[model samples]
Target: MTKLYTICFLLLIMAFGFLTDAAASESSFVDEIKNTNERFDTRAVPLARQVTEESVLAMEEYQGGSFRVLARKKSIERYRCSRCHTGKPVTAAQGLELTHGNIALAHGTEGPGLTCIDCHHAQERDYLEDKKGRKIDFDHSYQLCGQCHFRQKRDWLGGAHGKRVSNWAGERVVYNCTSCHNPHSPRFAKRFPATYSVPLD
Candidate 1:
Protein backbone atom coordinates (compact mmCIF):
# COMPACT_ATOMS: atom_id res chain seq x y z
CA MET A 1 0.00 0.00 0.00
CA THR A 2 1.11 3.59 -0.54
CA LYS A 3 2.74 5.28 2.49
CA LEU A 4 -0.06 7.88 2.77
CA TYR A 5 -2.76 5.19 2.54
CA THR A 6 -1.00 3.14 5.23
CA ILE A 7 -0.90 6.24 7.49
CA CYS A 8 -4.62 6.87 6.93
CA PHE A 9 -5.41 3.22 7.79
CA LEU A 10 -3.40 3.52 11.05
CA LEU A 11 -5.21 6.73 12.00
CA LEU A 12 -8.62 5.07 11.46
CA ILE A 13 -7.57 2.12 13.59
CA MET A 14 -6.52 4.45 16.43
CA ALA A 15 -9.82 6.34 16.35
CA PHE A 16 -11.80 3.11 16.42
CA GLY A 17 -9.83 1.84 19.40
CA PHE A 18 -10.34 5.10 21.30
CA LEU A 19 -14.08 5.10 20.68
CA THR A 20 -14.38 1.47 21.78
CA ASP A 21 -12.51 2.19 25.01
CA ALA A 22 -14.68 5.20 25.77
CA ALA A 23 -17.90 3.26 25.28
CA ALA A 24 -16.65 0.42 27.46
CA SER A 25 -15.65 2.81 30.22
CA GLU A 26 -19.06 4.49 30.20
CA SER A 27 -20.83 1.15 30.30
CA SER A 28 -18.78 0.01 33.27
CA PHE A 29 -19.51 3.19 35.21
CA VAL A 30 -23.26 2.79 34.69
CA ASP A 31 -23.03 -0.83 35.74
CA GLU A 32 -21.26 0.20 38.93
CA ILE A 33 -24.06 2.58 39.89
CA LYS A 34 -26.58 -0.16 39.17
CA ASN A 35 -24.77 -2.68 41.32
CA THR A 36 -24.48 -0.18 44.14
CA ASN A 37 -28.20 0.54 43.89
CA GLU A 38 -28.99 -3.18 43.90
CA ARG A 39 -26.95 -3.78 47.01
CA PHE A 40 -28.70 -0.83 48.57
CA ASP A 41 -32.03 -2.34 47.59
CA THR A 42 -31.19 -5.70 49.15
CA ARG A 43 -30.46 -4.09 52.52
CA ALA A 44 -33.34 -1.63 52.28
CA VAL A 45 -36.20 -3.72 50.86
CA PRO A 46 -36.75 -5.82 53.98
CA LEU A 47 -36.57 -2.80 56.26
CA ALA A 48 -39.09 -0.98 54.04
CA ARG A 49 -41.44 -3.97 53.99
CA GLN A 50 -41.44 -4.02 57.76
CA VAL A 51 -42.65 -0.40 57.75
CA THR A 52 -45.87 -1.44 56.00
CA GLU A 53 -46.82 -4.12 58.49
CA GLU A 54 -50.03 -3.69 60.54
CA SER A 55 -48.08 -2.67 63.64
CA VAL A 56 -47.28 0.71 62.05
CA LEU A 57 -49.94 3.38 61.46
CA ALA A 58 -50.06 6.03 58.74
CA MET A 59 -48.85 9.41 59.98
CA GLU A 60 -50.57 11.76 57.50
CA GLU A 61 -51.49 12.52 53.89
CA TYR A 62 -48.72 14.98 53.10
CA GLN A 63 -46.33 13.92 50.33
CA GLY A 64 -43.08 15.70 49.50
CA GLY A 65 -39.38 14.79 49.67
CA SER A 66 -37.41 11.66 48.99
CA PHE A 67 -39.94 9.05 50.02
CA ARG A 68 -43.67 9.40 50.73
CA VAL A 69 -45.34 6.57 52.58
CA LEU A 70 -48.72 7.47 51.14
CA ALA A 71 -47.29 7.07 47.67
CA ARG A 72 -45.37 3.94 48.65
CA LYS A 73 -48.61 2.28 49.75
CA LYS A 74 -49.19 1.63 46.05
CA SER A 75 -45.84 -0.02 45.21
CA ILE A 76 -42.18 -0.07 46.18
CA GLU A 77 -40.17 0.56 42.99
CA ARG A 78 -42.95 2.73 41.58
CA TYR A 79 -42.83 5.54 44.14
CA ARG A 80 -40.89 8.54 42.83
CA CYS A 81 -40.56 10.98 45.75
CA SER A 82 -36.83 11.05 45.17
CA ARG A 83 -37.08 13.21 42.03
CA CYS A 84 -37.21 16.36 44.15
CA HIS A 85 -35.75 15.40 47.52
CA THR A 86 -32.17 14.24 47.39
CA GLY A 87 -29.91 12.23 49.65
CA LYS A 88 -30.84 9.29 51.84
CA PRO A 89 -31.97 6.23 49.95
CA VAL A 90 -35.63 5.93 48.80
CA THR A 91 -36.17 3.05 51.21
CA ALA A 92 -35.13 5.14 54.22
CA ALA A 93 -37.98 7.57 53.53
CA GLN A 94 -40.40 4.68 53.17
CA GLY A 95 -39.37 3.35 56.56
CA LEU A 96 -39.89 6.71 58.28
CA GLU A 97 -43.70 6.40 58.48
CA LEU A 98 -43.84 2.92 59.94
CA THR A 99 -40.53 2.44 61.73
CA HIS A 100 -41.10 5.66 63.67
CA GLY A 101 -44.82 6.41 63.34
CA ASN A 102 -46.12 8.78 66.06
CA ILE A 103 -49.80 9.56 66.60
CA ALA A 104 -49.64 12.89 68.46
CA LEU A 105 -46.57 14.62 67.03
CA ALA A 106 -48.42 14.99 63.77
CA HIS A 107 -51.25 17.11 65.18
CA GLY A 108 -49.65 18.95 68.10
CA THR A 109 -46.31 20.89 67.89
CA GLU A 110 -48.37 24.15 68.23
CA GLY A 111 -48.58 24.84 64.44
CA PRO A 112 -48.05 23.42 61.00
CA GLY A 113 -44.62 21.88 61.52
CA LEU A 114 -41.83 21.06 59.09
CA THR A 115 -41.31 18.06 56.85
CA CYS A 116 -38.45 15.63 57.57
CA ILE A 117 -36.10 17.20 55.00
CA ASP A 118 -36.76 20.70 56.30
CA CYS A 119 -33.88 20.15 58.72
CA HIS A 120 -32.35 16.85 57.76
CA HIS A 121 -30.11 16.92 54.67
CA ALA A 122 -30.40 13.37 53.50
CA GLN A 123 -27.68 13.51 50.79
CA GLU A 124 -25.57 15.82 52.93
CA ARG A 125 -25.70 18.03 49.85
CA ASP A 126 -27.71 20.53 51.88
CA TYR A 127 -25.57 20.05 54.96
CA LEU A 128 -21.95 20.84 55.72
CA GLU A 129 -19.64 18.71 53.66
CA ASP A 130 -16.44 16.99 54.73
CA LYS A 131 -13.02 18.25 53.62
CA LYS A 132 -12.63 15.12 51.49
CA GLY A 133 -15.48 16.29 49.23
CA ARG A 134 -17.63 13.49 50.49
CA LYS A 135 -21.16 14.53 51.46
CA ILE A 136 -22.06 12.46 54.50
CA ASP A 137 -25.58 11.16 54.26
CA PHE A 138 -27.30 12.61 57.31
CA ASP A 139 -29.25 9.85 58.96
CA HIS A 140 -32.57 11.70 59.22
CA SER A 141 -33.10 9.98 62.55
CA TYR A 142 -30.32 11.96 64.24
CA GLN A 143 -27.92 14.39 62.61
CA LEU A 144 -30.48 16.12 60.42
CA CYS A 145 -33.17 16.11 63.10
CA GLY A 146 -30.78 17.66 65.61
CA GLN A 147 -30.55 20.93 63.67
CA CYS A 148 -33.78 22.21 65.23
CA HIS A 149 -34.14 20.31 68.48
CA PHE A 150 -30.91 21.54 70.00
CA ARG A 151 -31.88 21.16 73.64
CA GLN A 152 -33.60 17.85 73.09
CA LYS A 153 -30.81 16.58 70.87
CA ARG A 154 -28.31 17.56 73.49
CA ASP A 155 -30.37 15.83 76.16
CA TRP A 156 -30.67 12.80 73.95
CA LEU A 157 -26.95 12.74 73.29
CA GLY A 158 -26.30 12.95 77.02
CA GLY A 159 -28.40 9.91 77.93
CA ALA A 160 -31.68 11.78 78.37
CA HIS A 161 -33.85 10.76 75.39
CA GLY A 162 -35.51 7.48 76.19
CA LYS A 163 -32.43 5.30 76.85
CA ARG A 164 -28.95 6.10 75.69
CA VAL A 165 -27.55 3.76 73.08
CA SER A 166 -23.87 4.06 73.87
CA ASN A 167 -20.67 2.11 73.97
CA TRP A 168 -18.62 1.53 77.06
CA ALA A 169 -15.83 4.11 77.49
CA GLY A 170 -17.41 6.25 74.77
CA GLU A 171 -19.82 9.14 74.41
CA ARG A 172 -23.53 8.44 73.97
CA VAL A 173 -24.97 8.04 70.46
CA VAL A 174 -28.46 9.32 69.73
CA TYR A 175 -31.01 8.16 67.19
CA ASN A 176 -31.88 10.36 64.20
CA CYS A 177 -35.25 11.68 62.96
CA THR A 178 -36.25 8.29 61.60
CA SER A 179 -35.78 6.87 65.06
CA CYS A 180 -38.65 8.99 66.39
CA HIS A 181 -40.82 11.02 63.98
CA ASN A 182 -42.47 9.92 60.79
CA PRO A 183 -41.64 12.27 57.85
CA HIS A 184 -45.27 13.21 57.29
CA SER A 185 -47.20 16.10 58.87
CA PRO A 186 -47.46 16.46 62.66
CA ARG A 187 -43.86 15.50 63.23
CA PHE A 188 -43.17 13.92 66.64
CA ALA A 189 -41.50 11.00 68.30
CA LYS A 190 -42.69 7.58 67.19
CA ARG A 191 -41.88 5.93 70.48
CA PHE A 192 -42.99 8.63 72.92
CA PRO A 193 -46.56 9.60 73.93
CA ALA A 194 -47.98 12.00 71.29
CA THR A 195 -48.57 14.62 73.95
CA TYR A 196 -45.98 15.72 76.49
CA SER A 197 -46.07 14.18 79.95
CA VAL A 198 -44.18 14.57 83.21
CA PRO A 199 -41.66 11.88 83.86
CA LEU A 200 -42.75 9.33 86.43
CA ASP A 201 -40.84 9.23 89.70
Candidate 2:
Protein backbone atom coordinates (compact mmCIF):
# COMPACT_ATOMS: atom_id res chain seq x y z
CA MET A 1 0.00 0.00 0.00
CA THR A 2 2.83 2.46 0.92
CA LYS A 3 4.62 1.79 -2.40
CA LEU A 4 1.40 2.34 -4.38
CA TYR A 5 0.76 5.71 -2.62
CA THR A 6 4.36 6.82 -3.35
CA ILE A 7 3.98 5.89 -7.09
CA CYS A 8 0.68 7.89 -7.31
CA PHE A 9 2.39 11.01 -5.75
CA LEU A 10 5.32 10.76 -8.23
CA LEU A 11 2.90 10.47 -11.19
CA LEU A 12 0.97 13.61 -10.03
CA ILE A 13 4.31 15.57 -9.74
CA MET A 14 5.31 14.55 -13.34
CA ALA A 15 1.89 15.65 -14.73
CA PHE A 16 2.24 19.09 -13.04
CA GLY A 17 5.79 19.51 -14.44
CA PHE A 18 4.62 18.69 -18.04
CA LEU A 19 1.73 21.18 -17.74
CA THR A 20 4.11 23.98 -16.53
CA ASP A 21 6.54 23.26 -19.42
CA ALA A 22 3.70 23.41 -21.98
CA ALA A 23 2.47 26.69 -20.49
CA ALA A 24 5.99 28.20 -20.68
CA SER A 25 6.37 27.08 -24.35
CA GLU A 26 2.96 28.64 -25.27
CA SER A 27 3.94 31.97 -23.54
CA SER A 28 7.24 32.11 -25.47
CA PHE A 29 5.45 31.41 -28.79
CA VAL A 30 2.92 34.27 -28.13
CA ASP A 31 5.79 36.71 -27.26
CA GLU A 32 7.67 35.74 -30.46
CA ILE A 33 4.50 36.40 -32.58
CA LYS A 34 3.98 39.79 -30.88
CA ASN A 35 7.64 40.83 -31.54
CA THR A 36 7.39 39.79 -35.23
CA ASN A 37 4.12 41.76 -35.68
CA GLU A 38 5.73 44.91 -34.07
CA ARG A 39 8.78 44.60 -36.39
CA PHE A 40 6.52 44.24 -39.48
CA ASP A 41 4.37 47.27 -38.42
CA THR A 42 7.49 49.45 -38.04
CA ARG A 43 8.75 48.39 -41.51
CA ALA A 44 5.33 49.02 -43.18
CA VAL A 45 4.92 52.62 -41.91
CA PRO A 46 6.46 55.35 -44.13
CA LEU A 47 8.46 58.27 -42.60
CA ALA A 48 6.90 61.73 -43.22
CA ARG A 49 9.15 64.63 -44.27
CA GLN A 50 9.13 67.90 -42.22
CA VAL A 51 7.49 70.89 -44.02
CA THR A 52 9.23 74.25 -43.48
CA GLU A 53 8.25 77.87 -44.37
CA GLU A 54 11.32 78.18 -46.67
CA SER A 55 10.32 75.01 -48.57
CA VAL A 56 6.75 76.36 -49.03
CA LEU A 57 8.09 79.74 -50.25
CA ALA A 58 10.46 77.99 -52.68
CA MET A 59 7.56 75.92 -54.07
CA GLU A 60 5.41 79.05 -54.49
CA GLU A 61 8.25 80.84 -56.34
CA TYR A 62 8.62 77.87 -58.71
CA GLN A 63 4.88 77.71 -59.58
CA GLY A 64 3.98 81.44 -59.28
CA GLY A 65 2.89 83.30 -62.45
CA SER A 66 0.29 85.75 -63.89
CA PHE A 67 -2.83 84.04 -65.25
CA ARG A 68 -5.72 85.59 -67.24
CA VAL A 69 -9.34 85.10 -66.14
CA LEU A 70 -11.09 82.27 -68.03
CA ALA A 71 -13.63 83.51 -70.63
CA ARG A 72 -17.27 82.90 -69.53
CA LYS A 73 -18.54 82.68 -73.14
CA LYS A 74 -16.23 79.72 -73.88
CA SER A 75 -17.34 78.06 -70.63
CA ILE A 76 -21.07 78.41 -71.45
CA GLU A 77 -22.39 75.02 -72.65
CA ARG A 78 -25.62 76.46 -74.16
CA TYR A 79 -24.77 79.78 -75.86
CA ARG A 80 -27.55 79.65 -78.49
CA CYS A 81 -29.68 82.48 -76.93
CA SER A 82 -29.09 84.47 -80.13
CA ARG A 83 -30.07 81.52 -82.39
CA CYS A 84 -33.81 81.94 -81.68
CA HIS A 85 -33.77 85.71 -81.09
CA THR A 86 -31.78 86.51 -84.28
CA GLY A 87 -34.87 87.37 -86.40
CA LYS A 88 -37.20 88.28 -83.46
CA PRO A 89 -36.78 91.65 -81.77
CA VAL A 90 -37.27 92.07 -77.98
CA THR A 91 -39.53 95.12 -77.37
CA ALA A 92 -38.83 97.17 -74.22
CA ALA A 93 -42.59 97.79 -73.68
CA GLN A 94 -43.69 94.09 -74.03
CA GLY A 95 -40.75 92.60 -72.01
CA LEU A 96 -39.71 88.87 -71.97
CA GLU A 97 -43.11 87.31 -71.02
CA LEU A 98 -43.69 84.43 -73.47
CA THR A 99 -40.30 82.62 -73.78
CA HIS A 100 -38.29 83.84 -70.74
CA GLY A 101 -40.97 82.99 -68.14
CA ASN A 102 -38.38 80.96 -66.12
CA ILE A 103 -36.14 84.05 -65.83
CA ALA A 104 -36.96 86.20 -62.74
CA LEU A 105 -35.46 89.66 -63.36
CA ALA A 106 -35.37 90.57 -59.62
CA HIS A 107 -31.84 91.97 -59.85
CA GLY A 108 -30.59 95.61 -59.52
CA THR A 109 -32.00 98.53 -57.41
CA GLU A 110 -34.20 99.66 -60.32
CA GLY A 111 -36.72 96.80 -59.66
CA PRO A 112 -39.26 95.51 -62.30
CA GLY A 113 -38.97 98.70 -64.37
CA LEU A 114 -35.79 97.26 -66.01
CA THR A 115 -36.24 95.28 -69.25
CA CYS A 116 -34.20 92.57 -71.11
CA ILE A 117 -33.12 95.08 -73.76
CA ASP A 118 -31.64 97.27 -70.96
CA CYS A 119 -28.58 94.98 -70.72
CA HIS A 120 -28.91 92.69 -73.77
CA HIS A 121 -28.22 94.03 -77.30
CA ALA A 122 -31.53 94.17 -79.28
CA GLN A 123 -29.82 94.65 -82.68
CA GLU A 124 -26.93 92.12 -82.42
CA ARG A 125 -28.76 89.58 -80.10
CA ASP A 126 -25.42 87.60 -79.87
CA TYR A 127 -23.48 90.19 -77.81
CA LEU A 128 -24.35 92.19 -74.66
CA GLU A 129 -25.01 95.93 -75.01
CA ASP A 130 -23.63 98.57 -72.67
CA LYS A 131 -25.60 101.69 -71.56
CA LYS A 132 -23.96 103.53 -74.53
CA GLY A 133 -25.23 100.83 -77.05
CA ARG A 134 -21.66 99.45 -77.61
CA LYS A 135 -21.45 95.70 -78.46
CA ILE A 136 -19.69 93.78 -75.65
CA ASP A 137 -18.60 90.16 -76.09
CA PHE A 138 -19.92 87.55 -73.60
CA ASP A 139 -16.28 86.88 -72.60
CA HIS A 140 -15.96 90.59 -71.58
CA SER A 141 -19.37 90.74 -69.85
CA TYR A 142 -17.55 92.34 -66.94
CA GLN A 143 -17.32 95.52 -69.05
CA LEU A 144 -21.12 95.54 -69.49
CA CYS A 145 -21.62 94.96 -65.74
CA GLY A 146 -19.00 97.63 -64.94
CA GLN A 147 -20.97 100.21 -66.94
CA CYS A 148 -23.65 100.30 -64.21
CA HIS A 149 -21.98 98.80 -61.12
CA PHE A 150 -18.56 100.46 -61.34
CA ARG A 151 -17.90 100.12 -57.58
CA GLN A 152 -18.52 96.35 -57.60
CA LYS A 153 -16.34 95.99 -60.71
CA ARG A 154 -13.51 97.88 -58.99
CA ASP A 155 -13.78 95.61 -55.94
CA TRP A 156 -13.92 92.53 -58.17
CA LEU A 157 -10.76 93.66 -60.01
CA GLY A 158 -9.04 94.38 -56.65
CA GLY A 159 -9.74 90.76 -55.49
CA ALA A 160 -12.27 91.70 -52.81
CA HIS A 161 -15.23 90.01 -54.54
CA GLY A 162 -15.57 86.71 -56.49
CA LYS A 163 -13.64 83.39 -56.18
CA ARG A 164 -10.08 82.86 -57.47
CA VAL A 165 -8.87 79.75 -59.32
CA SER A 166 -6.23 77.43 -57.72
CA ASN A 167 -4.12 79.11 -55.00
CA TRP A 168 -4.23 82.78 -53.94
CA ALA A 169 -0.40 83.07 -54.11
CA GLY A 170 -0.15 81.78 -57.69
CA GLU A 171 -2.15 82.94 -60.76
CA ARG A 172 -5.03 85.42 -60.15
CA VAL A 173 -7.70 83.76 -62.31
CA VAL A 174 -11.04 85.06 -60.95
CA TYR A 175 -14.65 84.20 -61.84
CA ASN A 176 -16.95 86.85 -63.32
CA CYS A 177 -20.01 88.28 -61.46
CA THR A 178 -22.31 85.99 -63.49
CA SER A 179 -20.51 82.94 -62.06
CA CYS A 180 -21.81 83.57 -58.51
CA HIS A 181 -24.80 85.89 -59.09
CA ASN A 182 -27.54 84.68 -61.42
CA PRO A 183 -28.26 87.01 -64.36
CA HIS A 184 -32.03 86.66 -63.78
CA SER A 185 -32.32 86.53 -59.97
CA PRO A 186 -29.06 87.78 -58.47
CA ARG A 187 -30.39 87.82 -54.85
CA PHE A 188 -29.46 84.69 -52.86
CA ALA A 189 -32.26 82.83 -51.04
CA LYS A 190 -32.14 82.63 -47.25
CA ARG A 191 -31.45 79.21 -45.68
CA PHE A 192 -30.67 77.55 -42.36
CA PRO A 193 -27.01 77.26 -41.24
CA ALA A 194 -25.21 73.89 -41.52
CA THR A 195 -25.16 71.55 -38.49
CA TYR A 196 -21.83 71.21 -36.54
CA SER A 197 -20.37 67.81 -35.58
CA VAL A 198 -18.56 69.07 -32.42
CA PRO A 199 -20.54 70.23 -29.33
CA LEU A 200 -20.56 74.02 -28.92
CA ASP A 201 -20.84 73.81 -25.15
Among all candidates shown, the one with the greatest TM-score? 2
Candidate 2 weakest ten by summed lDDT = 53-62
Q: Report how far off residue 84 is in candidate 1 (Å).
A: 8.6
Against the hidden true structure, what lDDT does model 2 obtain?
A: 0.67
- Mind giving the per-residue lDDT tens digits that candidate 2 earns over 1-201? 999999999999999999999999999999988878444467465443322211111111112343345466655555757766767566666555666666777767575566788888887777889888899777667778788788987677677767665455443566667777777677788887687587788
Candidate 1 residue lDDT tens string, 1-201? 699999999999999999999999999999988778434355443321222321221222212212221121223232333454565455654665654365334522468754444443346433433334334343323443455566865565444664423323222233334445453452443596669988899
179 Cα displacement, candidate 1 (Å): 1.8
For all candidates in order, the CA lDDT equals 0.44, 0.67
In angstroms, the error of model 2 at 24 is 23
Off by over 4 Å in 1: 1-112, 115-117, 120-141, 165-174, 185-201
Give the least accurate 10-residue stretch of model 1, judged by summed lDDT.
Answer: 53-62
Residue 197's C-alpha lDDT in candidate 1?
83
